[model samples]
Target: MSITRSQIADIAHLARLALSEQEIPVYAESLSRVLGLVEQLQRADTAGVTPIAHPLPGQRQRLRPDEVTETDQHELYQRNAPQVQAGLYLVPRVIE
Candidate 1:
C-alpha cells in the first residue's frame, strides 16, 4: 500500500494537478498512509454484520402530521396574468 513518487506523479497528471517536487513527496507519504489504513480495515471481520439506515436501531424519526395548512389561492393569482387557460398560464413562444 506504500505509494511511490512515480505513482504520485501519475495521480497528479490524471487529476490535472500541478504538484511541485517538494509537494509530490508529501502527497505520496500522505496517500501511502491512507492506503495502509484501508488495508488494515480490509482485514476486519464483518461476516455477521447487517447494513442499517440509522446507527440507533430503536430510534424513530419525528414527523409533522400530513395536513393541508394553506388555502387555495391559484384563482386569485391567475387574475393578474395576461392569459390563462385550464388553470395554466400561457406564454408567447420565443423559439422556432
Candidate 2:
C-alpha cells in the first residue's frame, strides 16, 4: 500500500493546494509514511473489541439538580446588545 509522488500531486490538485516542486516530494514522502503506519495497524490483532462512547463502561455525566440558583440582571445583559427591542436583543435580518 505504497503511495507515489504522482498520487500526492493529484490529491493536492484536487484539494486546491499549490504545493511547490520541493514541497511535493516532502508531501509524497509524508503521506507514504502515514499510509505505511496504517498498513502496519491493519496487520495487528483486534478480534473482539466493542466500541464504547466514554471508554469506561456505565459512566454517566456528573450533573447537579437543574434548579434556579440566582436571578440574573436583564437590563445589564441588554445594555451590551447593539439593538434591543421589547426586552430582547434584536438581530439583523439575514434574508434579502
Candidate 3:
C-alpha cells in the first residue's frame, strides 16, 4: 500500500495541484501512510455485525409534523406583474 514518486506526481496532476520536487516525497510518504491505515482497517473481522445509522442506542429520530404554514398569495403578488397568463408570469422569448 506504499505510494511511489511517480504515483504522487500522477495524483497531483489529476487533482490540479502543483507539487515541487521536495513536496513530492513528502506527499508520497503521507499518502502511503493513509493507504496503509486503510489497508489495516480492511483486515479487521466483522462477522455477524449489524451496521447502525446512529451511534447512540434506543434513540429515535425526531421529526416535525408536516403541514401548510403559509397562505396562498399568488393572486395578490401577481397584481404587480406586467404580464401574466394562466396563473403564470409571462416573459419575452429570448431563444430561437
Candidate 4:
C-alpha cells in the first residue's frame, strides 16, 4: 500500500491534473494511507450475511390503487393555450 512519487505523478497525468514537485510526495503519502485503509477493510469477514434492500426489517412500502380518478379535461386545458389546433399546441418555427 506504499504509493511512490512516480505513481502519484502518473495518476496526476491520467487525471489531467497539474501537480508540482512538492505536491507529488504529499499526494503519494495521502493516497498510500487511503490504500492501506482499503486493504484493512478487505480483510473483514462478510460471509453468511443476507443483502437487504431496506435498512429496517418488516417495513413494507404502501402503494395506492392504479386507477383513473379524474375525468378527461383536454378542452378545459386547451382553452388556456394561445394557439392550439387539432388537439395539439402550435408554436412559431425557429429553425430553417
Candidate 5:
C-alpha cells in the first residue's frame, strides 16, 4: 500500500499535528512502509494456531498472593486533619 502527500496532509490535519512541508514526505514514506508490513502480515497463513490469553502458553502468571502487606495507619495520619469521620477526611463542599 502506498500513502500519498494529500493523504498525509489530511491525516495531519485530522490529528491536529503541525507537520512541516518537508516532514510530510518523510511521514508518507514511513506510514507506507508500516501499512506494507501490515499487508504482508495479513497474507501469512495461521490455519491451526490456538489463540492464547498470555504470551507464554504453559507458564502460570506469577502474581503476589491476595493478602494485606501493610497495616492500617489511617488513624495516625488523620490526627493532623481538621475534620475526619468514619475514617474519611471531611473537605469543604465547593460545588453546590
Candidate 6:
C-alpha cells in the first residue's frame, strides 16, 4: 500500500498542510516507509497467541510500602520562612 505524490497532495489538502515541491518527495518516502511497516505487521501470524498487555508478567506492580515516619514538626518549618502568618507561610501577590 504505497502512497503517491497526488495522494499526498490530497492528504495535505485535507490536513491543511502547506508542503512545498521539495518537501513532497521527503514526506512521500517517510509516509511510504510507515505504511510499508504497517503492511508487514498485517502479514504476521497471531492466530492462537494470547495478547499480553505488558512485557512484564505480574499485574501487581512491586513498590516499597507507602509507610509513614515521624516527621510531624510544623513549627520548626514556619520559623525558617520570611513571613509567617497564623501557622502559615505568606508570599507577595502579583495579581490584581
Clashing pairs in 6: none
TM-score of each predicted structure versus truth: 0.45, 0.44, 0.45, 0.46, 0.45, 0.43
Q: Model 2: runs farther than 4 Å from truth?
A: 44-96
lDDT of 1 at 79: 99
Position 80, candidate 3: lDDT:
96
Q: For each candidate, what is the lDDT? A: 0.93, 0.85, 0.92, 0.92, 0.92, 0.87
For model 2, how does the per-residue alpha-carbon lDDT over 1-96 read when each residue is reduced to its tens digit?
Answer: 667889988999999999889998888888888888788777767789775778778989899999999798889888888999989888778788
Q: Pick the candidate with the highest TM-score.
A: 4
lDDT (10s digit) by residue, model 1, range 1-96: 899999999999999999999999999999999998889877789899887998898899899889998899999999999999999999888697
Of the candidates numbered 5 and 6, which has the greater lDDT value?
Answer: 5
Clashing pairs in 3: none
Stretches of candidate 3 exceeding 4 Å from the true structure: 45-96
Cand. 5 Cα-lDDT? 0.92
TM-score-best of 2 and 5: 5
- What's the residue-level lDDT of 28 in candidate 3? 91
lDDT of 2: 0.85
RMSD of 1: 11.5
Q: List the residue pairs that clash in candidate 2.
A: none
> Candidate 6, residues 36-80: lDDT per residue as tens digits?
888877777999989998987777777887899669788987888
Off by over 4 Å in 6: 44-96
TM-score of 2: 0.44
- Mark the regions of model 1 whose C-alpha exceeds 4 Å error after superposition: 45-96
